[model samples]
Target chain A: MTTTLTASKEQSCQTLLASGHTACTGCGEALAAKLVLGAAGSNVIVTDATGCLEVFTTRFPQSSWEVPFIHSLFENSAAVASGIEAALKSLGRQNEAKVIAQGGDGGTADIGLQALSGMLERGHDILYVCYDNEAYMNTGVQRSGLTPFDCMTTTSPYGEFSWGNKHNKKDMPGIAAAHNIPYVATASVSFPKDIENKVKKALSITGPKYLQIHSPCPLGWRSNPQLTITVARLAVQTGLYPIFEMENGKITKVRKVSTPKTPVEEYLKIQGRFAHLFKSPDGNEEIRKIQEIADRNIEKYGLA
Target chain B: MRLDLGAIAKAGTSKANQTCGWRNFKPIFHQEKCVGCGLCKIYCPEGCVTMVEKKKYTVDYTYCKGCGICAEECSSSDIEMVVEEK
Candidate 1:
């Protein structure tokens, strides 16, 4: 049962997502897209939102996708995917290809929320993936609904009067699971195998599924491009980004953090977005606040 | 009567657009020192790293953005990022 995605080192492998796109150097979204598509295999249809993922992959007469990919507006990819799924069902060929709708955090947790919720509520046989890099990376770094609390961005810049965003990060996976869908999972780019496994598991189950990947953005996050994997790994180790799977409105699995849990500073120090927290007089207080969030996650998921 | 959608592109035509010009650094694969971990193949955002054989890997420069991820993540440090001299 060796596919091109899971092909071992000795086997010849064919990636469904081709190379030579215009994504920023070491873009985590692009890497996650490749990993997801590879896991989905060639028999899948992808509908993309107008974000970095779509903008970079499809440029006029060039497309990095080897399989069928459709793009329209930023807020309607999930709707479009629903229509595609219905079309496949109407034609009695639903098994021919798996349907995937993808978007950035801005497109998913903000603008496209309505369509996504509709798709999930309607129980459409599709997989919706949100490549959450925290901010709107493509159209300059702006604060998004999924952006973490006290994170610096263009719209939520830290200043003498402000401490980054005033809102806490939206629990997207929890919202998706609240719909009582068949599956909802969170993964990070650090663990490519986790992503591959979750994608396969979500696709294997029927009905609507949602997968949110914590893809690290080097440019937007102001982190080192070469340390994209390192940043993603540290995020999970710090308990800032909990990896887990939910089935039938219940958490079925969780990736536990090893003993001597990594503090939030180790995760925050790598990204320039959190740099203001260390230099400002109110920085330590905010850092403590962030550590509380991680602590809550560790307690909630038993990731100690 | 007739539907007029926008222009259509062929599948995987992005391969035709060589991205090697974007690279300031080139990742040189030292096959002799390779440990066959396949970490480079998994981490490359460009998907340019390919496993040539067990304990061997090759990167396609034509599409390599030279982000240095492969070199930075190589298990055996078999992949080195060198300044691409014109």
Candidate 2:
């Protein structure tokens, strides 16, 4: 499909997710979407759930998707993808196009979990990717099941009445692995190459595969737009977000923290959502608890 | 009203939307300081940066939202973010 080269970086673009989306400046999910589809190539059908990615990219007529993409609802992307897979197999054209079902944290961890479970149980040949930006970002920053402990959201606003989202982030990778899927992986948007490689790896495997990608939200997370990659990198280095792969319920590989394990404060201080945790003695205790969570993750994942 | 088509948008591309007006600061690429590492192209969220010639890169201002990620992630600090003028 190479034509006269365009000056707008459109022809040189190696991705199926096109540019000029309405995603906030320095949107990590948009970047990750490009990386994922770039690796998966054009011969694929994508079923997306309602989220920032779907909303911004497919704004009806002014679309950014260069491939066949569908957004049925907020909680049925997996079911829709399963139908697509079955349809392809029935038509004897399963080999031609790969099916990808994707959603945000709310759709994946909370709203769409049942459909996802059914898709996994049925063993559909589709990749289910969760872009966990830690909240219901598209519909205003509300706390989702995957929202980290003490992270501020509209529903879990920090105050005397509450410490933002008292519940810890749900173990979605573990849940996906429990389904005995062929492959499950956790990725961050900072590591674009790793994400692309993991998308390729998941597509190569048969049976249901799960990829939970942690992308940053500049507006929701109250972080600087320019520091999107930096914030994601710090999340990994702090051991708060573990990057790993699971094969049939077994942890195969993990991204280890470097020599100087980055302090959690380096990550916390950059985002305004976590700014409340630095205010008082009570906040220090909360900060310590958050650090303990990071420490535990580092030890649990053998990141050191 | 009853219709045969099941709600589908006409064929379109987001390229129709010129997001350049959203820019608060624009990145000015300095060719002399560039080391040709291509990190800017890799990290640009909008996918607006491209290599016009070997080791020389240019950004598509038509679609660039001016997030300054290219400038921030630049290895040699070749891309500098300056306040957008009008």
Where is model 2 more than 4 Å wrong at Cα? A1-13, B1-4, B10-12
Q: Give candidate 1's error at residue A180 in angstroms.
A: 0.6
C-alpha TM-scores of all predictions: 0.96, 0.95
Q: Which residue pairs of candidate 2 clash?
A: none
Model 1 misplaced stretches (Cα beyond 4 Å) = A1-13, B1-3
Which residue pairs show backbone clashes in model 1?
none
Residues A102-218 of candidate 2: C-alpha lDDT, one tens digit per residue? 999999999999999999999999999999899999999999999999999999999987778899999999898899899999999877777877988999999999999989999
Which prediction has the highest DockQ against the true structure?
A: 1
Q: How far is candidate 1 from the true structure (C-alpha RMSD, Å)?
A: 2.9
- The lDDT of each candidate is 0.89, 0.87
Candidate 2 on B40-75: residue-level lDDT in tens? 777777888878776688899998999988888887
In model 2, the Cα lDDT at residue A283 comes to: 86
